[model samples]
Target: MLSDKERDQVRQTIEQQIAEAEKEMVVLKELTAAVAPDNSIGRISRMDAINNKSVNDAAYRNTRTRLKRLQNVLEKVDDKDYGLCMRCGKPIAFGRILILPEKRVCVSCSK
Candidate 1:
């Protein structure tokens, strides 16, 4: 279990990540919108736009998923078992949480 100060720090970090993910999602939305199908461009340019849109769509999905996971972690930050490994019922290391705030299992249990 983490101390109150540590939990606060984690919360702040997750909040910052949420803000960044939201920003990225907005940018991805704009990028995908700009690549909308149009007859004004050549076939090759249209193909490139299609490719870029696909990539941007995947990135947008990933960013949304990340944002949801982070939000879930933020909700659980004050829980008694917030940092406990769900598989092993052990305390997850602070370092692991620092690097992967959405982690629910410890390294040993994850393997």
Candidate 2:
């Protein structure tokens, strides 16, 4: 079992990461909405509409993936299993958190 202080540290780290991810997702959503064909101005053409739709689809998929990852991390936090190597059930190194805020496996177990 982890000490109280250690658990708190991990919680705080995850909280910060979650906040940043939410902020980024919000910005991405806003940007995507701005570029949506329905909201855009100027002359419209078939090719231009197709191109916009393609870009919108790509961006939406990317943002949704990121959001899902963030939500998964949050669920891990709720389960009190954050910061553990998912593969080996070992404690993940603190330094690894900086590189991968929501990593499920540590360097060794990830290999």
Candidate 3:
């Protein structure tokens, strides 16, 4: 269980993370834009560009998922079970929660 102060801290941290993730999503969306087929680049360079786009697309997806999880965690910040590990039903360490408020599992169960 977490005190009210700890919960507030986690809420603030999660909100900040959410804002950062949203900004990153916008940048990644630009990076993942379709590569023009008729570009004046060499074949190898075009291939490299395509590959980079694929990587950026994956990163964008991952960030989007994390953003959604953070939103969910923010909503649950005031709940009684907010800091409890989902795997073992133990209270997560306050330090760990401060660092990763979106995580639902503790260090022990995460292994």
> Clash totals for all models, in order?
0, 0, 0
Worst 10 residues of 2 by lDDT: 34-43
Q: Write the per-residue lDDT of candidate 1 for residues 37-106, one digit (tens) a residue.
A: 6788978999998999999999999999999999999999999998899898899999888778888999
Which of the predicted structures, 1 or 3, would earn the higher lDDT when compared with the native?
Answer: 3
- Which pairs, if any, clash in model 3? none
Task: Work out the TM-score per prediction.
Answer: 0.89, 0.58, 0.94
Summarize candidate 3's per-residue lDDT along 1-104 as a digit string, tens digits.
89898888898999999999999999999999999896689799999999999999999999999999999889999999889999999999988998888899
What is the descending TM-score order? 3, 1, 2
Predicted structure 3: lDDT: 0.92
Candidate 2 or 1, higher lDDT: 1
TM-score of 2: 0.58
| lDDT of candidate 1 at residue 52, scale 0 to 100 | 93
Q: After superposition, how far is residue 48 of candidate 3 from its true place, in Å?
A: 1.0
The candidate scoring highest on TM-score is: 3
Top candidate, metric lDDT: 3
- Compute the lDDT of residue 32 as modeled in candidate 1: 83
Q: For each candidate in the order shown, give its overall lDDT on alpha carbons.
A: 0.91, 0.66, 0.92
Pairs with backbone N, CA or C atoms under 3 Å apart (clashes), candidate 1: none
